[model samples]
Target: MNQNNKVKHPKGLTFLFLSEMWERFGYYLMIGIFTLYLKDVKAGFAMTEAEAADLYGTFIALVFLTPFLGGLIADRYFGYTKSIIIGGLMMGVGYCMMAIHSLPILYLSMTLVIIGNGFFKPNISTLLGNIYSTPEYEDKKDEGYNIFYMGINVGAFICNFFGAALYILLGWGYAFLAAGIGMFLGVGIFLYGMKHYRAFDVKKGMQQGDMSFLKIVMVILFPAVIAGVIGWVVPTQVLGHALIGSPSTDAFIFACIPVIYFYGSLLAKADKSEKRPIAALLTIFAVVILFWAVFKQNGSALNTWADRYTDRHVENPMAAKIFSGLSLSQQLTMAKDSVPLYDEAFRLQKADGKVLQEYNYPTYFKNVAPEKRLAEGTQIEVWATNISQSINPGWVILLTPLIVAFFTWLRKRNQEPTTATKIAFGLLISALSVLVMIGAVYSGGNGAEKVSVFWLMASYGVITIGELFLSPMGLSLVSKLSPVRITSLMMGGWFLATSIGNKLSGVLATLWDTYENKANFFWINFFLLLFSALVAFMLLKWLNGIMREKGIK
Candidate 1:
């Protein structure tokens, strides 16, 4: 029985896995269709590509930002279990509220989700860490987290199918409502397994030399709010135009200033023993910002690629029939409509205040060869674009076990790379992933024709490997290196980097319409990632030395 127990994971892990899976199901389901919903002319807001991408960027940035405060609050006031419950409930309601058509209600719902994520995201992970701190599970903590991460991707992978079916069969509202139901289901699972992790729900209120709750509110939160408001209002009101991609973008960047300062101050005030570790973590955080900036594009720019450029038409009659019966695909007619003519660079052409081409065709057929063009009334069954959002997580689900085995094999031979080494290599490999898109652009004749969905699949496959190497390792590095009292603060720094990177992704995506040569746009991403990898390689020795000082791999 003891030997069997050693081979098996704890019961709590199962519950945590189910809970996180459901929570992600709700979150990713909403994200999968968000921009598409925003751009729908009749049912959605009819936002332009830039407008939708900007909003999507801001929303996701805030979603990551709140976890800083949420984790802090859970540690100081609410315990992990309670905070997770509250956050989950808030998010559940927020998803349901998204079903409402009112703009005001949508904003309100978004705020709830941002705040809820702050509470739920960090606390649950922390609780898991606490559970694994026990002697029996300590050796297997990394395995546990890898398992937990897979649960997140599992939810992410399947939610798109449900979302596509629900939206196709009913409407966007029903799909959003399904997200809310998923969140509630997650909360229920967490509650049912409460006893398993209840012992680890301990909270440490105020500690010696720690700032009081009121002080934190006054110095950090209040200042951030004021700065954000000023950023939102001042740029357009004073300058007559946005200083950034959008007002929300400006606001988020400005709000981050105070928080950035706070983290900086920690480095200044940290003890000699703590100083080097904090600085090392901060340097890493800054470098990985480039990674998130590129990866987060899945929801915006990539979604657009899948929607407008990919060959999603289901050619197999049986497959098309299955998709149609399941409401997983939409049947679109190639009806003629007004579309603008393009110049040599593919920019829209105009003459005397009128579009050059009066014969408008559906956008999906814009790049098809004239000889291959279908009749005006011909109908095609095409898979929903949102389904493409699942590709990364699907890759995650498929590759994780293999990745774990590969790393485990290395560990046994004493040949596993250091965390820093893995991250540096991850960045380099991610840079290579951009070449796939460059290939895709060439294959599609710079958007003059549709390319096979296989290109997107291959790109996602490469990047998922990069993500597996860097993302989990970063989290573990923080736990291994941070001073006990300041660990939470360092964690906040990681999220800050992620939030900033997410916003940058949006900013880059806004330029999608401007780039006549789409390859140029992907090239920019490649360079950014390559630069980050170079920086990581230069710092690798020093970072590894710090790990040695801390006596961790």
Candidate 2:
């Protein structure tokens, strides 16, 4: 247990991994309940699904967008450890403020998290890469990132239970408060381990031929601010609020224009040596956007499916009791009679005595069949829908070791696929996960029946493999390929791709209400993924060539 002489990965790596794990646990916990909390009529915001998805998309997109600046600032002025601590605190406080429920306060809180993440997320990851850059651990960089990535999923996996319990036990506000607490704990852990990584947190201090910080602020940050203002102030409802999209969404998309331009400007201004690295990074970033677009739907549209369509009732006594007690159970039943519910299709209708969409307290039971339905007078205390969000992370925790070992074996044989190839294959395999949803559609006959939870589980299982393949490798690739001076900034670029894709996923999910045939929804996801995979496959040869030329392979 000697700290400095740790075998394989560095001690700093483990500390950072655990820090990120807890931070992500809190972040994902907040996200897992976010839209659901918004849409919950009782003890929730009572927003429609579409409204909630739009806001969720916008929030996540902006959360990622800020890292572009954060990374740059860290590389130039602020040290990595400092940035991470500040960012973590900001996010922790934001989560706590979400408990307030005031619109202005909620917005202020979200802004804090977004800005805080910009500082914390990219810098810690860059610091990890910096630690691995040492000659001793250099060979195991990819493995380091893979192991680090498992921490993220570990947090994501465990947060749902906490979120469900806090929300069910107390209320949505308390659940949100829990997220803040988790974030603070993460910060505390990271600070405790600061000595482990403090040596590597040195600032690069504006590398040779790099863009001057002030110039970037003028050209990029200022423009982004102006664009956001225009988007926000322009009367979307010129006469009434008739903008094509919501103000928040339009503002975010507009803000991205300047930020996107800034990244493009990097390519234009780069020296010959830097150009290839930047070009390579951009190509990979563009291709992976699709993977994120589909994968991130777990929050919006897919959550709705698990909440409404998937039959989550556990018949097994042990499992059912566990889930029910954990506040993660879902109850499903069949409503033979036409039930009055508040949906977009019948929003204006007033049939039931209760004005708000009133039906069976347990919404899942409404669409299920009699045979499968719980006996009358028998109340099934089932798990919460948000709990399903944990499945992918659960799989990641289970499968990462096996996947890592498989790759390690491949490395020994001098036969490991390059990171680019792994990412390409990940995209292809992720496309397959969508088909499972398509199957769920057919099996359930366009929502005329209740689909088995197995379909949801199976779809998640397939996607989790793809996720393990792509996500960890994507981090490894950026770390490996990026020039030392701009390492964290490139990571920001990677997150930028994710930001755009996250928004697109939200856009795609929001369209769920528009699709009459459920299969069409999944097909769209499939095609989007297929197209992304094809693009990645097309770039594989060139990317591999770069990897080999750089002596990274």
| lDDT of the candidates, in the order given | 0.88, 0.83
RMSD of 2: 3.9
Q: Which candidate number has the best TM-score? A: 1
Model 1 root mean square deviation, Cα atoms? 3.4
Model 2 residue pairs with clashes: 237-241, 237-242, 328-383, 328-384, 329-382, 329-383, 329-384, 330-382, 330-383, 333-365
Off by over 4 Å in 1: 1-7, 326-362
Cα displacement (Å) at residue 412, model 1: 2.4
Candidate 1, run of 10 with poorest lDDT: 338-347
* Residue-level lDDT tens digits of model 1 in 1-553: 4653566677889999999999999999999999988877667776677888998999999999889889889998999999999999999999999999888999999999999999999999989999888777787888899889889999999999999999878999999999999999999999999999999999988877667778878988899999999999999999997888789888988898998898888999898999999999999999999999999999999999998889887879998987784344322242223232221222233542222332222256567655556654566777888999999999998988998899899999999999999999999989989899999999999988899999999999999999989998898888889888777778878888999999999999999988999999999999999999999999999999999999999
Tell me, by lDDT, which candidate is best.
Answer: 1
